[model samples]
Target: MDETASPVESADCRAISEVLSRVGDKWTMQVVVTLSDGPRRFNDLKRRVEGISQQMLTRTLKALERDGMVKRTVCATTPPQVEYDLTALGRSLAEPARRLAQWVRGHLGIIHANRRQYDSRR
Candidate 1:
């Protein structure tokens, strides 16, 4: 907390920080973007996400579900089938996430060059 900051500002900052910590996570962003298309089964999502392990996918879905950003449904079948979809809140986040991804893609070359330059200087 800054010496001159009011309590309300501090509380707001804390709230923003907490939300950002979740939303800014790489897996969370990727999962949200993937689910933006529509609902997907566990194995399908795992395949589409690429590189994410089954355990990590499970954890990410659980976290999103807990945050009210995703809905999980279990279908009736011989073997229960589970699907994950974005909630309204998750859908709301999709646009901004897409924009951020676009921005990152646009800047990736420059970012890599900057990183390389900085690393070489060190």
Candidate 2:
């Protein structure tokens, strides 16, 4: 650890960094928010999340499922059906995620302005 870094602070930073690494993905948050509404079949989720490819959606869903943030169910019909919903733990993240989304939308203009100013400065 660096001299400036305490063990407790380093641990907290590592944990926060790990979480952000997981949820910091663009599609992850969108997928979570979509599932927050209700359980959805794979195709429906793909459609609702616009711009995500079949493979990308599949990968993101699988990762979320692996993280215990989402549950996957398969129906036993002739044409098998699959649906995904957030686990209780996953659902608990919705409010903070929603607030983050809202904050981004709210500040995008300012962000763009800052980016332009920074770019011009460089």
Candidate 3:
């Protein structure tokens, strides 16, 4: 019997890769996290996710909206206000994202030590 993991072209491999490719993007997770609290206006999101540029936030929110993970609402007002929140799918994803966040926090010290060791060897 032959035993080996499937190549990237395999259906499962490709699917997992596609999912991770989007989820692993730095901005996506931050966007999801910030929106988890409740609907937030554009400026609010920009402020909460520090270091993110206006252009990047717009692009990330758009991408998340396209993926069905976020809902964007525009209200008519003096100038118009837009708010963002997680859709059902996005909230579901947040559970895992939150878990991952906790895991990173818990393991940060060990992770940093490992990185130092690896870097020092080279």
Whole-model lDDT for model 2 versus the true structure? Answer: 0.93
Give candidate 3's TM-score: 0.88
Give each model a TM-score: 0.94, 0.88, 0.88
lDDT, each prediction: 0.94, 0.93, 0.89
What's the residue-level lDDT of 109 in candidate 2?
100
* lDDT (Cα, tens digit) per residue for candidate 2, span 1-122: 57799889999999999888889899999999999999999999999999999999999989989989999999998899999999997898877899999999999999999999999999
Winner by TM-score: 1
Better of 2 and 3 by lDDT: 2
Q: Which whole-number lDDT from 0 to 100 does residue 49 have in model 1? A: 90
Model 2 error, position 10 (Å)? 4.9
Query: Residues 56-94, candidate 1, lDDT per residue (tens digit)?
Result: 998999999999999999999979999999999999999
Model 2: lowest-lDDT 10 consecutive positions: 88-97
| Top-scoring candidate (lDDT) | 1
lDDT by residue (1-122, candidate 3, tens digit) is 12465564477777888878888889899889888889999999999998999999999999899989999999999799998999999998888888999999999999999999999999
